[model samples]
Target: MTGARAMLPLGAALALGLWLWAVRDLPWPGWPLDPQAMTLDQIRMGYGMMPRGVVALLAGAALGLAGAILQVVLRNPVADPTTLGISAGAQLALVLATVAAPDLLGPGRWPIAMAGG
Candidate 1:
């Protein structure tokens, strides 16, 4: 158990490193798929290399932990996050946001969705 605990950071670091390496050289496009193309390097660089990777990993871990907790609390093997209507609440918010103001649906969407849940 302790050995595995020590490997967690190394495992995460390796995963992140691999993801970055794979994406760094792939061809990524903006709004349009085009004949003249740029590699993934160009697309990532254009985004100014913002550190969203940590946030993404953290959010993923949080959701995973939440689902685990919810399943345990609900006392059912199949009680996933969706079983609690969380998924429906999220979908409803997305639909509402799309109808209300599609442009303002980035960060605000989750908060509104969770609130609805």
Candidate 2:
């Protein structure tokens, strides 16, 4: 792989580790529906829930990789999750889920939601 390509995973790992470390000590805000309110400690301490910080970091990295792939495939600098309608599709899916099936927003829902996108 090219240097930039080779560094991608390493960078993602570092970023993810940093993110998990940053939130590992924060208290969960007791908002079940809000991802931001969730914390690494809460995930470890209660219900065996996965860490929101890791989830967020992974999601960010995934999106970045997806965008890079799209841009390269399309030969367009502007190609991205937005240009591919992925962002809109994800938003629509979340809106529908929130309105029609709020239960899907619970723990372990992120991967499902992302898959839906």
Candidate 3:
């Protein structure tokens, strides 16, 4: 097997294990949804933090993919978000949106930022 194909499962398993460990102390030996086993705080924290962490992880992965694709497409190792001015342009658009039309960025700032980029 190719190196990446061989390593992907191992990497995914390691990440999953680390993520499970980082979730929180669960009510083991009892039921997962058993309120009597775990406190409300523990439940809230496990549920809340896991989703946020997943979202952050996904976002970072997406950005990494985008950067890699951009570099490959441009045939330049230095062609990243910042070097391509996408980062600066997006920031400028955010600033402009905040100043000129805050409402445009209220619910969905992605299209606006993308347009600006």
Candidate 4:
């Protein structure tokens, strides 16, 4: 376990290297090491792809964790956010908030979201 813990950073580095390598030839020019030299399209692609990777990982993790917690707490094998009506309630609240008070999305918006939830 200690040996595996020591390799965790290296493993993360390897994963990052592989991810960058996979996108190295995304119809873009030169590397993005020096942002000043990167074209607007290349910069855009880099930023866009970073979020695609980060947000997806985060959202997936959150949902999976939430589902697991809900199942455990409810003592059921399949109690997800949707099953508890949280998913729908939040969406409905967000839609209503968007229509009634679009400003709620600007800052300190989470309380409103929780209300929706």
Q: For this target, which candidate reaches the highest TM-score against the unseen true structure? A: 3
After superposing candidate 1 on the true structure, give the runs of residues whose Cα lies further than 4 Å from its correct spot: 1-50, 93-107
Q: What is the TM-score of each candidate against the true structure?
A: 0.45, 0.41, 0.64, 0.54
Clash numbers, per candidate: 1, 0, 0, 0
Error of 2 at 38 (Å): 28
The C-alpha lDDT values of all candidates are: 0.72, 0.73, 0.80, 0.81
Please tell me which model should have the higher lDDT, number 2 or number 3. 3
Where is model 4 poorest over a 10-residue stretch in terms of lDDT? 23-32
Q: Lowest-scoring 10 consecutive residues by lDDT in candidate 1? A: 27-36
Model 3 sits at a Cα RMSD from the real structure of 3.9
**lDDT tens digits, residue span 36-78, model 2:** 5666566564535445545766898898798778889999988
Across 44-80, the per-residue lDDT of candidate 4 in tens digits comes to: 7777876788899899789878787888889988777
> Candidate 2 — which pairs collide?
none
Off by over 4 Å in 4: 1-32, 39-42, 91-109
Indicate the residue-level lDDT of 107 in model 3: 84
Strongest candidate by lDDT? 4
**Which has the better lDDT: candidate 1, or candidate 3?**
3
Superposed by TM-score, candidate 3 places the C-alpha of residue 100 at a distance from the truth, in angstroms, of 2.3
